[model samples]
Target chain A: MSGVKQRVPQIILTVVALLLIASAFVARPEGGSAPLGPRLLAIADQEFATWFSILAVFAFLMGGLNLVATHLAKIRERGPDRFYSLVTLVSFLVVLVIGTAKLGGPPGLQGDVTAPGSWLTAVFDAVLSPLHATLYSLLAFYIASASYRAFRARSLESSLLLGSALVVLLGRIPAGRHLTAWIPEPLAFLRVEELSLWILRVPNTAGQRALMIGIALGVIALAVRMIAGVEKDPRSGGDGS
Target chain B: MSGWFAPGTWNIALVGAFVCAVIVFSVIRSRRGAMVAVRPLPPLLALDRAVADAVAGGRPVYFVAGSQDLDNMQTVAALAVLRPLARKVAEAGGRLFVPTNRSLVMDNAREICRRAYLDAGRADLWRDDWVAYISDDHLGFVARVDGLIARERPGLCVLMGFFASESLLLAEGGHHVGAVQIAGTASAVQLPFLVASCDHVLLGEELFAAGASLEGDAARLGSLRGQDLCKLAAAACLVAGSLVATLADVTGAQPWLFLRDAFLNVFRAG
Candidate 1:
């Protein structure tokens, strides 16, 4: 574990050096206009981006290692949920080996890991994809349950929330139009569909845009803080986790 | 060698200037601890009361840190938020239940909770049983989370993170359990479910801004101001673009074309 951890700092320093060097030379200049330093930096940045992506891959491997260690320890200790640990480890190793080994090689060794008609592909498509989709779809049921309890018409704000929810909900459905169809063309602006559009487009969009502005600022601040290496941590500053 | 005016060189220079200005602005602002104006949610207070009740009622505070791994900005912001929240929960003598979808997230959540408890002077309240790592299988995580919400019947459920479809599910379950549900996520796609279900929904960037807003740290607030400046720049560009278009419409001079070209120059390919 220490051996594995040692590589991270080295990698970080290498990446910083690469980025700094590359920042000098940018990318291909229009009209063959790039100066030597900028051109070199641009090229370096491209190479850096290409190579640095591997860090994510390594992190994934690290995740797998952590998973293996934890689960194995769980199984050994006969922990309260040892069976689940075994299940996690089995699933992880199965995915790892199959994905990497390209079991059956799909259409022989030359094929991509996820090539169509392959076992790996099948497992992912049949198992992983639907599994992900199913988990994602759970939101639908959750929304229904959460909304029923939270959206009670208790007070003014709650009532307003209910009203907005209704507008947004009705606007998303055809029934909004079915009910509001009697309104004349001139007065159609008051229709649920139109109102929904206004709510999403005006207030929602405006609000989203405003938040984006704030987020961008926060990111900049975070980046600056990280670069300057501020040691403050809300948690005990050890590890800054 | 191409002169500084060469399109590529000029664009880089412009970007450099922009970056430098932002950096300078942020550096200065971070040093001057400033408070940002944040809209207080009266409903959020109601939410706190509801959560307190749930805890008093012997239910847990079910918190989901979204499905994202730690690297995501939304996740980091979520962690920042969880600090204060975990503190508040501990201070209230409530049990905080965090069921994470990712193993790394699970570890981080535990560390965060540990720190929070320590900070709140209730380190003893922290327990391994509280922060559990469910399966990474997204659906499995949701099912397990859903089950916990049902079984534990937490007094308050807070789901904050970079969620996808699971946002609706988690919030809904919390609501069903009669927990005070306050949810926040930066993912626009999941906002509908959250907006519909959660008692207090922090919209879009507010999720990021709220952490800084709540902390009232000058550096964070300055960053907020920097973002405002960035937005101003964007708005200025939009207004300028519109004005040029309007003038071009009247004068038949196509002023917008030049403005567009200028904008492109700023954003032009390397």
Candidate 2:
């Protein structure tokens, strides 16, 4: 893999990737509102996309191999953290064997490894599903704790936070209308539900959108850096020696 | 028949104007020897060094690729940091432990680590166990990762990615362990917790750019530049739109709806 032959393949692959990427953006799609160039680009884009997707699959395979090799070596070295390696290998092999042997399931279109009564389904439902539920469930406790801590009335911002939270929390609850029912028709704007709606639509949504915009900008900057290859991965920046 | 700018042209023009203004300002500043200097990579390197040292001293470096699939930009950012982090650990002979809630992420992390190690010529040191997949259950994953941290007692822990309430529990646990922690997330909800507990917190865009900042890749830089350009354009449009709407409201003219529709159409096209 370190020889000149490897370099040749790498170079070829790089060239192919560059050309495809270029084509995807440069050529135009046909018979649309877009220009001829753009139409050509669209056709080229589909072809490039398909090829790129296949390449990604290969990348995934390469990654899987690396994963297996890394763990296998750990087991062989009997490293102090070897138990971790053991667990990893066990999990990988169990899934791999189950998938290949189609264990606990009947075959389907592509050999339904995921068919009912299959170990895959069992693992997914019993192991994976429960795990997801449990992790998601933690949000309840975390949200409560965070709310208590964040809702403290320390400053103007804190007051706003507490106020908004109260409005929303109360509005959603059955107790809100009962509490606000005494308000006159003209003052009905003070209803908890209406207040909550206003807060969400005006303040909460506005803040969320602003944050989203900032995030979008940041992502663009980062993408430019990567595309320019100026932001080399530190690992690759090391001396080849 | 409409030119590129058309009614939507104002936004692009505004961005162009801003850039021109900045360049002119920068030139003037440079001539006066008052040019602002920027060093973007040092903080990331320092953080990496801190993470590496912690991992090197027989303590694992805890890393989570957020609660997202690798496709998410935040997840990619986490992996970018992980690449250097894993190498530093490999070089220092320390372990890098990444417990992923997403199976695909485990795959991505493994690839990134392997590439890092191979780049370092210490591919032999990279282990699959280094990036393990726990339960996909968010809380289950959190519990398992937390347990791993408790048992491993890593010197440094980094929680970066799209997070929610689970982020708090993880950060709090890291705090309890007395590990030096660095956290980054786009989720504003989790930012306070990370800031409260982690030694360093990458907020919002900082999290998005952390990966690109770690590397001085021109492509990534260009993307950042493009994004900034887009943002400038957006801001200009925002101001213009607001003014137009206000003016239209004050007078009998109704240009505001046209501008709004134009903006909406442009955004929809994008």
Best by lDDT: 1
Clashes of each: 13, 51
Cα RMSD for predicted model 1: 5.9
Candidate 1 local Cα displacement, residue A174, angstroms: 6.2
Q: Model 2 clash tally?
A: 51
lDDT of each: 0.69, 0.67
Index of the highest-TM-score prediction: 1
Q: List candidate 2 stretches off by more than 4 Å.
A: A1-40, A52-56, A59-88, A152-159, A238-241, B1-59, B67-71, B79-144, B163-180, B187-200, B211-233, B254-270
Residue B240 of model 1, lDDT score: 81
User: Model 2: per-residue lDDT, tens digit, A1-241?
Assistant: 5456435644554555455444533423334565654455456657766976676576556545755677678789987767876887788789888888888788654778877889898888888777677766765666566567667798998798788888898999998878898888899889888898889899878777777777866654444334333344333434321
lDDT of 2: 0.67
